[model samples]
Target: MLALLSLPDVALAQQKARTVDDLAKMYDVASCKQCHAKVYEEWEKSTHARSLIGTGRTIGGFQGMIRAGLMGAFTKSGVKDVGDVKVEHLAQCFKCHLPQISDATDEVARELVKAYLDADRATLGKVNVNCLVCHNTKAILHKWQDGEPEKGVVYGSKDGPHPDKYPAMKNSVVMKEAAMCGQCHGTGPNFEFPQPSQCATAYGSYLHAYIPAGGTETCQDCHMKKDGKGHLMPAYRDPDMAKRAVDVDVEARGYKFLLKAGDSIPTAVVTVKITNKAGHRIPDG
Candidate 1:
């Protein structure tokens, strides 16, 4: 047996968080506010911050996914109810919503499901896609090329010695790439699971439709750079961001015309044109 002291940092770090509280402590976001006050404030208002507890919709979605899908006859997931849920079962939804759930135990998965099912806001709010999630856990898209995310190292735009809990900070090769956001923003259908899910497909449209149609801007170029909202990463939900994403033109005209050199005829014409100026398809998940 491998002694605890001799275990590799990755294995030791992810010794399997025992509960929702334990997972929350593993990737605590509150501590980051000390060093990143402004960015943290922006993130506080983002969908990522409220991933599992968003306007009652996200939690409601999970309740349905669990009751109607995971526990339903269609999936054959080998579960009769939420009580039987495990980490693999929740991965369908939590893969992006609360990715840190992966490090947690099956009991934690069951607990989270019940919490969401009952709309227990306090407990559901315990975890989110926070600093450690983006700048660390999910920073590297290709583990083979960039190596697995280190336990204590934080990935960012610059390489240096971070001041607080995270002792190291290294620049990630894909941090600024659209693929970074694509990791969660997703392509069509996540085939990683047995029953495929079509949760998010914005990245797919961005590549196939937006880029193919002479669009050059990237996801970050617009969301983080042009919008300049930083961690907020506003999308269709924000009125201003939604308005700016598309351009609409309406034209109406009424006129009278002589029909076959006989009686005068009245005519009306109207035209509506909508141009999608954003980097991807409008109304994409």
Candidate 2:
């Protein structure tokens, strides 16, 4: 009992000593890319890479879109001054869109946003999704201490090299589950949209229907396959991928014993069957 009780105290002390930069180093994709060159190269071309920053029609992509939507919501709520819109109010958007920023508390987000507003474009634009955001197996273990991530632990799906150098390295099975992807994909009500909306309904639909129907495949199995290469989650974005997700068949039957010549024309019954071959409902999200 004494040993168990002391554990929390020890953890608290360690957490208090760490800074935001310490946690950032542990989660930095740049550091990770040194060893994971192949994975980094693949991810570089993926939509995930441009989640926070992009160009052309994809400028800032989803992150920019969410920010614009939130700004609109804030405007509607009487926050006429753009400067008055607090980063805390946009926490929900950061949760998934800016996971690195969201990993820390709202105060940290506020500080970062302030720095961003004050700094040059080249400096502020460095913010984006990092490795630990989605790949962290022990995501539940992540917590905030003094407006930064709790120190001494970094999680992933598989064991990594240099565990001795980086004591925070650890593996977890949860990273392999559909629930991991559902963290953002199965989002609920937030500041912008308070009502329950059809966001990423794949996981919910899978639970209620697919699981009971004896389905075992996870979101990764299909979305992270050949065309995606575990990074690009191509759905409607890729024409061929969308077509491959569902199987369709048409059957027709004609009545042999029809009515008289002038009577009602012989009718043919056509049946069209559509099967979801991707483990979730078609057109998810």
Candidate 3:
């Protein structure tokens, strides 16, 4: 006799036919974890992973900052109370903090923001930073188009299996360019600051100094590859990495008499020098 087996709910869900747009909307860091387990695990410990909640080094993350900004904007705009502040006004905050939601319509984004305002933790958690913001090679294309992604295109630095299913699986050189990071890290209007200012000017600084000085290395070379750890781009988080970027020295001159021999004290001159070995200026961005 033959035995019949039933598919699990998750298996059934995965088996359901989905358009590329639906897949893009459904995919998250957890989905990526199904295949790239090691990369997912490493990213789980990274600053990018905590970018939404502001854990680890990000203390009081983007959510807190956005709320503060909304409160201030409402106060300045003569809105009577925090409850009166419209969610639509605050939706732009998702661009960097929650790129997936940001790509959705303003109406959809407003609903998510409203959920957060209503103290719905589950809805807020859904908006946390995800994988595709960086890894998606067609991020630029998707970003500018303002609609569902092309039907069967999947962009990345490498080609994946099932090219017949995903026709846009083309290798992209932009993934390896410093400008790729500049999409977020480069100069941009400062949302947190009250006064107008450009935030995250690392790309501009690198171009102004590093490129002009005949430096050919990309940001990934120093931050990602220097330690042989792929995704953990250590900056201030690693003391050794920070130290490698610059050298410090101290020198003291001999004491000199400043007054009459019996009545005066001598003073010594101390000098401290810091030499930046990195191509760009120290404390970039």
Per-candidate TM equals 0.87, 0.62, 0.66
Rate residue 89 of model 3 by lDDT: 52
TM-score, cand. 1 vs. native: 0.87
Candidate 3 local lDDT, 1-285, one digit each (tens): 976546785475455323323323554446566666877776777666655444442334433544665555435633343445443454444445555543444344445445555654444544445456665523443344444344454556666653333445544456777876666566556555333444566787788888998899988888778877667666655787779888989999977675875766767899999888775666754
- Alpha-carbon lDDT, every model: 0.85, 0.56, 0.57
Q: What is the lDDT of candidate 2?
A: 0.56
**Alpha-carbon runs more than 4 Å astray in model 2:** 1-27, 53-78, 103-125, 141-152, 158-165, 187-198, 225-228, 248-275
Write down the worst ten-residue block by lDDT for model 2. 141-150
Per-residue lDDT of candidate 1, residues 16-97 (tens digit): 8978899988888687899889999999999889889875467778888888887785557888877788888888778889
Candidate structures ordered by TM-score, highest first: 1, 3, 2
Stretches of candidate 1 off by over 4 Å are 1-14, 252-271
lDDT of candidate 2 over 176-269, digit per residue (tens): 7878677776633443643223355677777777888998887777677656566656665677776777788999999755477756666789
**Per-residue lDDT for 185 in model 1?**
87
Candidate ranking (lDDT, best to worst): 1, 3, 2
Top candidate (TM-score):
1
Counting clashing residue pairs in each candidate, in order, gives 0, 0, 0
Q: Once superposed on the true structure, which residue ranges of model 3 sit more than 4 Å away at CA?
A: 1-27, 55-69, 73-93, 104-127, 141-154, 162-168, 188-196, 253-268
